[model samples]
Target: MEPNDQPAPLLEGRFEGRNDFIQLVRDALGVAAQAGWRELILSDSNFYDWPLGERAVIDSLNAWARGGRQLTLLAKSYDEVVRRHPRFVAWRATWGHIIQCRACPNADALDVPSMIWSSDWVMQRLDPVRSVGVAGTEAGRRVAARELLREWIENKSAPGFASTTLGL
Candidate 1:
């Protein structure tokens, strides 16, 4: 590994496609609960297949929230699910944090306040001076985070809500 190659501390954005998103959401829930991840930054692509994604996303959020962690959604704007889903909307209104990505169009009308993930949030949170020096060695944090998430999925006590399909 190059001395300068390091994994960045990520607050990732993902699209919903097939089972990958499902797995990711499940893993993210575990990571948030076990590793102290504070926010989940999402992109507009998250809405591509609305219902499945919503089911997975909402379940994950509820699971994490019930376990006492926070969820932050970055949105293009308000949509039916965000506006009508009793659980998510309530969370956003009272418990969850939101960030609007205005560049995504229609994001300004989102009903919640959200921090921009790419430019403002991660940049500010990651210490460039410190990370630059130890970027290569600091990757252990990411590996550990992934392991914690995987552990949660394997634990039957915290099994994520089942998807209708076989999760095949």
Candidate 2:
């Protein structure tokens, strides 16, 4: 078979409302999972709530992690995430090794939006309360987004969550 060089179409949009945003995230995650993504990096303060409320998303994440993919989360405040979404605490307890979390002390400077990125795709949530954001699968966009995430993680001195301290 000949090589296929055409670039994947951009998967971009603005979602309105929590359900829509959740669905958008679900779709994005599903694509990444199906594509056999090796790693996922997420930067969000309130992401715990989304997965806690959406069982399918949680299931998908668990399944993805079980398949040996790494899921890293960089959050502004772990206490806040757990406080708002206690279910996450429980979930993390079960999948702590696979779904690792890090603390970002200077999350404000990295403020484009909350985002989830894999090697092949990127999803960003622009508005926290309104659930408005964009997602794309273009290689350039994914690379740029992934670079931004890497830089943010490196610059902020993000630290991995300690299960002993966090009681996870």
Candidate 3:
């Protein structure tokens, strides 16, 4: 099924308002668990504005893992600095089950613009592939995503991606 065919799992927004962040995280985790997504890409390069966004994301990831589901978190490597802090160590442990990827080469940060741009590049990449599925293992999906990215670039005239992009 398509990622949208199933509900798009909750991804914490850029801001986390103190206690509200907890609820946001809980909700995101709930959606993820229910969706049974194998990978979850999170972009926190902008979390610099909301100091608590990162923490909330980690907390929500923990809650998602606790539910006994697999999820891959996509973020820049720098965020690991925050994760390595003593304060974040415990939360990290709870998040041990989730996989994280640096979105630099893949999708960059998880903002709307980035996602838009990334999807175009991704759609272009996948356009050439005979088939694709996001429900597969992380490794499998990454490989497929790459293959599609290549196809997307190689064949620019493809019909589905003609739109100039909404502004990712």
lDDT (CA) for every model shown?
A: 0.34, 0.68, 0.35
Candidate 2 residue lDDT tens string, 4-98: 44333435755667887666667666655555578988777646536543567666665566677787888776676666655556667777777
**lDDT (Cα, tens digit) per residue for candidate 1, span 1-168:** 245654233334333333443343344444443444455443231232233235555555554455444333433433544445546555444443332222233223332122212111221112211211111113454454334333322331121111122655
* TM-score against truth, every candidate: 0.38, 0.76, 0.35
- The model with the greater lDDT, 1 or 2, is 2
Question: Which stretches of model 3 miss by more than 4 angstroms?
Answer: 1-27, 33-38, 50-59, 77-89, 103-168
Name the best candidate (by TM-score): 2
Using lDDT as the measure, name the better of candidate 1 and candidate 3. 3
lDDT at 25, model 1: 35
**Model 3 TM-score, all chains together:** 0.35
On residues 1-168, what C-alpha lDDT tens digit does candidate 3 reach at each position?
A: 345575554332233233443344345444554455444433333223222335554554455565444433223333443534433445545455443323332433432111111221111111112211112224544465545434433332122211122665
Which residue pairs overlap in candidate 1's backbone?
A: 76-107, 98-114, 99-114, 99-115
TM-score of 1: 0.38
Residue pairs whose backbone atoms clash in candidate 3? 41-74, 42-74, 113-168, 124-152, 125-148, 125-149, 125-152, 126-148
